[model samples]
Target: MSYLKFDKDLMINLEYSLYRNILRTNRKGAYQNTSISGCNTSKYQGLLVMPVPFLDDDNHLILSSIDETVIQHGAQFNLGIHKYNDDNYSPKGHKYIREYNIDSVPKTIYRVGGVILSKEIMFSSKENRLMIRYKLMDAHSPTTMRFKPCMAFRNISQLTRQNDQVDRSYREVENGISTSMYYGYPEFFMQFNKRVDFMYQPYWNQGVEYIQDMQNGDTFKEDLYVPGYFEMPIAKGEEVIFSAGDILVNTSALTDEFNAELKKRTPRSSFYNCLKNSAHQFYYIPKTDEMYLLAGYPWFKVRARDQFVSLPGCTLSVGRPDDFTKIMDSAIPHIQDFLNDKPRKNIIKQIDDPDVLLWVTWALQQYWKENKPVFKEKYVDFLFSIIDFILSNKHPNLTVDPENGLVSTYGRDVAVSWMNAVQNGKPVTPRSGYLVEFNALWHNALKFAEEVAAATNKEVLATTYEEKALKAQQSFIETFLNDAGYLYDYVDGTYADRNVRPNMIFAVSMDYSPLDRRQKKLVIDFVTKELLTPVGIRSLSPKGYNYRPRYAGTSEEKEYAYFNGCAFPWLIGAYIEAYLKVFSMSGLSLADRVMIELEDQMQNDCIGTLSEFYDSSPPFYAHGGYSFAMSVSETLRAKRLIRSFG
Candidate 1:
């Protein structure tokens, strides 16, 4: 498959200023201007406005600039004129200019200037004009932008209808004139109602309010301005200045017209430039060849450790070998720590965190799979040390019941995996007994270690892990399997939770010993019957008591409910793998059919793309959309699974 196909004629020009503000403009009367400003309680962020022109005649046009500004801090900064465009533009003749003063005041000022960025635009063939989009970041903080707007039109015909006819709706309205606002000073208002939603992080300390009014009719008008700050501490020779002339445009007409205008404008490959730029932004460029390191989300920075966990299949398996090397090299220090019995915690602290360990181990295995020469010469010792640590440290507190092979995590306030939840400074899933998925991962880890040891001629270590793997396998079958042939959710002697969830799929799909044909069929049956959704796999079966349909509440309540019933698209990749494995084992056609169904479902339900998650209810609502790097990467992986079966 060709991964680098570029539409050369697409003239979607996007540029960013020194202040990191964006400007986009196209030939089809579509333009977007955005910036970042303010600090403290009055700080706010979002697109200033999107201009859509209505043509009265070929010579005369009616253009409207829908300007929007967000306040970040609560009543800290006051309104000012800032600057005006007339100072730079000298109109030829018969040109009209008007400036409707916007109110910028104490309510919008804050300590940190609101940061607003723009997404790459794909011109619409149907819209004749361009459609633009903008977002309000970090809205749930102590103070947020109030979204003051002003409509500026020059050389325009008068509007026949009143201001109410303009269709000015707020907070997710597509083409209407309605005004809705959020109440907190620093809260977010999501765009594209169907695709994304916001979840407040536990650390944020702010509120938000969204306001809009269509009171002015045709000429030009300004809404109330709330003041805020965009404060960044500068070093000794540091200074910041603002420029006001860049414009962003993405229109189908412009993209189509680019082919004719290409030679006249610049002598360069626009398509190649776009791809190169995208590749650079999506993954770190130059340093890592094919490895796509995620720059955390828009609000966060690129984390080295998180990238290592997702690098193997997410980057290497997708054909970026250069990126693979960079990721491995970057992770060597942390990899050595895992080998030396000092595994790193979530941050930089040297404490044994199992999820990080699992990620490091997985990366090592993938590196070995791709490049054997480096594996033997450089990684052999590192691999063994990781294996030794897992075998020795992981099982110390884990107690295996005499009758069953179930291993329970026993330690003070330790939740082992990434699902580790701390509520009010207390560990929530402090499960002292057998947890289902953790052991499944443990079993796979041991089996992988055994393979690596045997390959490296370390028979003594290989035999030890092999024995442990067999014992765990035997115990897993005995304790977890019920009369129905499907596995129990978790086991603690008298307590065996029988929830039908997606966690069990890992055991069936991983490199551990395979389940019996009947057991595999039963697992597929249970999962397909209860957990599948249109966009992805549900975290838990709806029939389970703890399942909740909606995922909205206070921070504490939402955090507690995150795992109970939320649907995750990444898990669907696992389901596809598990289904294929079961089909191969049982010689069943149902699993193959479901794989096809899932692929079609993903494309249609998720805005012609995939996302991090979706609502679990029917016609599953797409959430956390917008180029979720993992969602696209995993869907590509799942596509490979179907192809391999074929």
Candidate 2:
């Protein structure tokens, strides 16, 4: 685990109750001109944006450009919340108005740019009301954009209520309902005199002319009114009017000024800088409850929990016991279903897949091994639960082929694992049969289960898992090993796929009894020659038919080409581990040199920040961010692996 200079007070404040919203507005032709609206109560923050829409020559709008903008804008809104909203507060009510201003304002003192903009306005609090005014100084044509606001709430009191009602049955009363007022476009403005039902729409597909309803006493509502309007050719030195009006009835106590004062007390410490320089490559956002891997570039994004490949180096080497606990707690609940007799599908599904399961088990085992002092009875129980889950749900029908214990995964119809992809609703890579890497992962998982069971004094469970692990190892070796001594990527009798992929590295890296010295050397040589790149390791060898340089094209082309030849920086951990294993066995001087080269390579490619993947071509570019955790974690692990050599 990595050590970070985290402020306890700041961390606590981040966990406080808050809601936020932002509104960004920009013109059609001039993309540079932009305005933002920021709104929040003491409990929440909200955001919305009006972006420059890219148009074609014929005056017809390009759907692709619109889609891209929406995705990018939406992603930015999500990132802002993930980055800033320390306190999670859910928004209540149906009518929401967010405004932005670019011109100078009386109360506006701080400005990120020349634009003194009011970021957001929310209609959640009964006593507190937020209002933002904006004046666009210059733009080609006025353009307006709407945003779907996401709200998070503090449920401390609700938890107490839930606990109290756990044993007793009581009637819950719902009160304090607020209704949203609807207005028709630039021509007509229609305000709803009475509450009406509002239809919830997807974030991306939100357009004008949508109806919504108000819910009584609920902190969250699906459909909320956040509308925008922009008139083009406003001419130079002109302004646009934007503001939100709040209507509060039957509430005597009003505290808008007090709430504003409360918001002002929020700490503005630059924690991002600390995170950037920290030994750990990634940081977890407590409010959005997601992890971010600094993938060098600003644009790359990824899911948090998929960093199993980077965990050892990211958390363990940095000595972040707290992070380790968070990782375990966060992931265990989602993965618990897989541990039971009836396998529970995770949010992403495919939790039963060996690779994911093995990765989780590996992380837990390493955590226990490194932080034994912090290993309490609860930790042991958690580990045992995972072990029991894996043991009980052994797919009897889903056996490895007698010829090769490889598992199969395939196309759209059958969901094999998290890496599952379908093109046009058809499975892109079918592996419904035995796949080599799956078995390799399974073998390692069983070994880890056995180790955990033994360590926790579950002797009978340990013995059973050990027997299963042994059988798996035997089956894997017999089926996957080729005449050349290197493991085959996959095999189905005569139809054998002898690809030099990185999946085989896990077999030697995680297994208790890895490949023999000669076999290890051979595997390393093959991988280095075929899959290794200056930035990292390629998913497939360049010599293969599927190989394509890592460059953006159409969506289908990009996806197909990416895995075929794209260099995944995360795989460096496995490669480094495998190299160390080989060096330990052979007493090679090249091991130290390789370690130095690897570190230099990572730093050079990522510019001090590890990335998800690098281009498998000249002047390789890094892509994605969330996966950076793996790269950072692995680099840290590689340092430890080198230290072990010393």
Candidate 3:
């Protein structure tokens, strides 16, 4: 009945279920990620991954996993699955799973002979906590439930091994206990809504293997500490809730708190709604006054370019304009510090990336198209300043060519652009010159700022901006456009790199393009032929020299595939926009087909959300980050554009 339901056949098949994972976030950096079979297949897969700001910038796996054991008449069935050495599974409990779905929260139903129990997991919306509600749906006899938590108090990226360094100590708190494995880390608290008996039998779960990490050429084995287990009795139709977090809570009010959090969640009932739900998870609000857009889950962080690129769709298109403003306003100080050549004192990384500041203006452009008055009132000055700063050659890596007004990268690193995958300290895709997309964005930013300045009665500034835009527009067409009608990827002075990449699509997609209608149509057609995949737009054409057909194999192979030919869903926004721009209503068929093909993605990869990138070819298996902000945001934007055809 649920949209994302997995039945007994699929649940029992480890090959099908173990690779597919589910993710839940608190929007304050804490999250729950694990395989559908309740197996911890990745080091990043945890029951309670919390952000310990005092310790470091990365999210820590405080509660690696919690195994649930259902006991009846002196017999116990552990409804938990863990991979060990030689690919062996311990307490292989996935076979007991009758169904697994995420209609509201992720719920896994298990039937063990005479007892049928359901486990529902949810992360608190505002706190660093993971709550799992266990209900004995139907029981022939009295059932006792035992919870054994696997603790690994280490950064999510790192694997832990058994060491005497762990304190291995605990203290009572509320209806449960709390303990910290390390000195600098916060103590983890585990409690239940009802009174339970705690059995302090410490054990080590040695060499637990992560299949995904093993495939990706990482340290796939780890030792998880099992401090003890909690035993409690359950009756028919009775529900008991378990909580694991960084702080103690009022056990009595946990039921109400769980319900409260549930009400705030958007049900993943349909494709758009599932995206809306996943999109909301990327929001990181450390405090009520401060906010940031996390780039992706299980890894990544508050990246500057990602924040701006993800802002409008994740916030504005989702009808959270208030949140849009909240995030944009929070970025003001960082923008100021970057432009002024001051110390970069912010959590948002890559502020020095040449294209990061330009993307900020593009985000403004997207918002401006929807709400003009608010754009003028709230963001005009910010746009004007940033554009002026770029034009002045004050950006650390960017400068305007005095002769043509086209902004060029001066001393920028090769990996600074979005094709940022590096191997052996060198870029796989060295785009270190006048990038076509950067100039397209530069020209768009110039024109948008000029329009705002003119409207605001800043006549002198408007004239200056317009003059520069006109020069850039003329030079862009002359320098980037080739005899084949498509644009070059980048121009290193006299040498124009004629690689058929997705970067040229921006020329047709942007609000203000230097290309004429015919030129735009040609570029769009070229992109449709070379870069367009069934899933999205590929980073490079399949015919390119280093083009990779898939996003699979070892870590090194994936790094080679990262920007070589991997299709990025984020570029779908621009491709769809360009298609609609050139073909108008006539483009609806392809647009609908693209969206339909993408709809199937929700069932694969990470379940309800889009992955960071897909294989450039058929049966496009998702790769890179599990839940990417740009992927969700831009796909939402494309959907909004398609709906506008009505």
Best by lDDT: 3
TM-score of each: 0.55, 0.54, 0.98
Q: lDDT of model 2 at residue 497?
A: 70
Q: For model 2, how does the per-residue alpha-carbon lDDT over 1-646 read when each residue is reduced to its tens digit?
A: 1111112232223221111111111111100000111112211112211111122111110110110001121221111212212222222111111221111111221121222222222222221123232333433433232223221111111101111111111111111222222121111111121221222332321111101001112232222222221112222343222221123332222134323433532121222222223333234332345333322222222232355555666667766667767656665665665444455432323445455665666777677777765764547677666555445445432443334333444422653543344567755554444566567676676777777678778899889878777776777777778997778776654566776677777766664643567877888888888887766788788888877767466668665665667887667667777887766735335545544544443223222345567778877765543225566566566656766767
Preferred candidate (TM-score higher): 2 or 3: 3
Tens digits of per-residue lDDT, candidate 3, 114-169, equal 89999999998878989999889999998899999999999998988999898989
Which candidate do you rate higher for lDDT, 1 or 3?
3
Model 1, residue 599: C-alpha shift (Å): 6.5
* Among all candidates shown, the one with the greatest TM-score: 3
Which residue segments of model 3 deviate by more than 4 Å?
Answer: 411-413
Worst 10 residues of 1 by lDDT: 97-106
State each model's CA lDDT, in order: 0.43, 0.43, 0.89
Local lDDT at 331 for model 2: 59
Error of 1 at 211 (Å): 8.5
| RMSD of model 2 against the true structure | 15.9
Q: Give the TM-score of candidate 2.
A: 0.54
All predictions: root-mean-square deviation over Cα?
17.7, 15.9, 1.3
